[model samples]
Target: MSQPEHDAYAASPRTLEVEDLHVSVGDHLVAVSGVSFQLRRGEAVGLVGESGSGKTLTCRAVLGLLPETGEVDRGSIVLGESDDRVDLIAAGRTVWDRVRGSRIGAVFQDPGSYLNPGITVGRQLVEQLRVRGGLGRTEARERAVGLFTEVGLHDPAGVFQLYPHQLSGGMLQRVLIAIAISCEPELLIADEATTALDVVIQAEILELVARLRRDHELSLLLVTHDLAVVAETCDRILVMYGGEIVESGPTEQVLTDPRHPYTRALLAVATIGDWTRRTLDVIPGQPPSAGEEMPGCRFAPRCRYATQACVSAPVVTTEIGPGRSARCVRLDELDTEPGAVLVQDRIEATA
Candidate 1:
């Protein structure tokens, strides 16, 4: 069957548009190339990919936390607001200092790595609350305690006094989340925020986030590879491959009826429908190094349907819905299925 064209995205009351964005790691490496998407208020958008697909980098760019070596080349992050469309990329440090943690909060992959081992957990939360969230010292401390309880922590006062090294990975993660969401920012970026936690903790965290977003009318940009997380938490999905978006649409649409070739393989491997009948599912080929420039579709080397057309086809997305799109050569003929042979059976190749 032919795939639906991009005009099919569901209607939403509010939106955050990211248009033609680019991120560079240095003089030569461009991590993400002209990426774009819309995130609605009180909704979740998942950018799905492996580590180097530029998911984290894109999130950091939004929060003004990109590494010194990394830079946002050009783009528009149109955050819906009462007045003034905030220009994140062109904003000054003073503007960023005001916006970063106050208007935008980030829950990164490693909470332990970010939390200061020397400081007590309570002190860190209180300080951030006072400085960014705009509470007095006493009020911030109380708010900190409130956040712990909100996140399902017991003995919140005792956990506050605990040092980073004294807590388990899950505890530290929850504490970090409390700090991130303490201010109730309009946007939240969760870059594998649940990675270190066990299954129970992960599920709890996801639920907590979903609840909070709905209650507070928050927008979330979730970067995760776990397909289940996408199914449960996100309304829409953006599939990233080799520093560009390969496919995106409503989560269900993209999952059940994928359009792009890369999207097809991802859905095949992740679909819950009939995985029981197949052996292990995997996508073949090591991703290309962004350090070197390549032409055409980046996933073409691994895509089963690739022909010569993909070799030089500049990466571009065809519209399938209001906010759904993808960069694939054979969008019309794409099919979601298990490969004839194991994707693993093939040798590693790059486009």
Candidate 2:
């Protein structure tokens, strides 16, 4: 009934809980605001939206890896096993260091940039295993080989001895996965992990991640702009806009029956079928820059259903369905079905 009650019901044995998160750069640039979400143990959550919507920033905040200028002005990142929640915003370096790799791991977009070119893959992975899990060199090497094999890498021994540049993109991604899960973290933050790969490779990587999750029983925070990817890999979705979560709910509920105008627009033009004659639909106008303060709803400028109330009213999340909410005043009046608009050419092609 109340927000607190809904949150209490939703916060069931959370592996990661981010409440009222506010991240800012320098003085006035608020990168993320009033962001809140939870990753249940062994569940996958998708933070989906366009670039600069604070998806990556939210993940970074969870991992205590914010940029030097960035600061958590408000909110708390509560993370741990059941009944062991720790507010990471108040935690010091010692706490962060302990939790960063062993308790929680990350797999960023590009393996090229994240992995070292000079170091052998096995060496880097061994170092992580040794440092994070405190294994002896011999034990760490054995663990590294097992991790490599677990992530679907062939010839684990041979691959481990090679540098990052020597491997293909898919192999490099597998290596990254091995490194991320080497310590068997409880939560894994994957920020656009499949963005750089081709379609076939992307699918393979997605499958690998899904299998790894099953094997490891890790909670996943998948941050990406691709709704399709989210649909395929995540169980829940959080749609962000202009650094705030505009809509959030079950993945199927949000995708097939989006309540927010932004979410609907995203679905309308998703190259669903027969794209040869279909011109992709695009959201009008541009998203506001990070920390760009707005008087009202940030998507008001591009929303076709926007009105004076939308532009003037104080924005807050209203529960639309079970465990689902949207940050809009006119949620009641908006159409429940996705009104994805396509180009005239697409309409004719369909006819």
Candidate 3:
């Protein structure tokens, strides 16, 4: 894919800063707690964990599309830098109307669901172009076709007239991507965007995202449960569990020398480059329920190295290395070298 012309919006720094964000559902259930991360301009960050880990909630919180029963209880989600920054949590409808789609674009898992079934996909993109891009009808139509082409769609003009259901999964996703980047948003949040597709399609989507990020200089917050996906596409990784980030660092560093037990466990089970068929290792215990209170580390119950110290008091997130942090009471005790025995291997060896 070729790089598009640099627009005024692309010149500004678009940094997504989420600080101590807490999301609450219903009256008292805190679905996300103390979750924080930053995505700088032209950077790709992956938020990875098993389901029920509040990844979607965090994404929703940033997008201001949380369910009616859910709201940000505390913390701030600021976009942009310096005088141009806007706190999404405090922003009202007017601010949100200007921010979403225009400033920050998102592509979710179900592309068909987000699109209007009755409207032709091309017309959908055209509407966004006209409304958000402030282009005339003719100009919007031309730009929409160009966007479809930019996203690598075949027969872009022909595909424009098809409804959501008329397209294949990969094609629909591409259409969604066309709409997402049509406004030239600086930040793109892809929440499980490739989860529903097959392996080949998934790889295509990841490559497309990477290309778009490079061409557009767009910051990416890719939310997924697959570490392999992060390993391939993201520059940094945030390993989330039970509503909080358990470990975060440069992708290569964390994958090779994981400081947190939960991260190691995830790496052990992940099918990254190991093509040899074998029994898949599984994390021994279930993730804690949303808003489930725990005395110490959230993953202590499942961690093989956990002891009384790990459960007696809340584990504080500590900096283990440059730009690397993990929430574990036993971080010092654990081996942080590459090829270290994983917790799962230890369990299997004993069993």
**Best candidate, lDDT:** 3
Which candidate order results from sorting by lDDT in descending order? 3, 2, 1
lDDT (C-alpha, whole model) for all candidates? 0.79, 0.85, 0.87
Tens digits of per-residue lDDT for model 1 on 81-189? 5574576666656787787777777887789999999999999999999888779988999999989888778899999899999998788888888888888788888
**Looking at model 3, which ten-residue stretch has the lowest summed lDDT?**
1-10
Cα lDDT tens digits, model 2, 1-351, are: 346755765766678888899999887599999998888888899998888888888888888999988888899888875566678778767898888888898988898799988899999999999988899999999999999998888999999899999999999989998888988898999999999999999999999999988989999999988876887898899999988999998787777677888887777656533346346567778999986767889999999889998888668999886788899888889775444443332335665
Candidate 2: TM-score? 0.92
Q: CA lDDT of 203 in candidate 3? A: 95
After superposition on all CA atoms, what RMSD does each candidate show versus the true structure?
A: 5.5, 3.8, 5.9
Off by over 4 Å in 2: 1-11, 81-83, 272-278, 336-351
Clashing pairs in 1: 5-320, 6-319, 6-320, 6-321, 7-320, 7-321, 7-322, 8-321, 8-322, 9-322
TM-score for each of the candidates? 0.88, 0.92, 0.91
Error of 2 at 325 (Å): 0.6
The per-prediction tally of clashing pairs is: 10, 1, 0
Query: lDDT value for candidate 2?
Result: 0.85
Model 3 TM-score on a 0 to 1 scale: 0.91
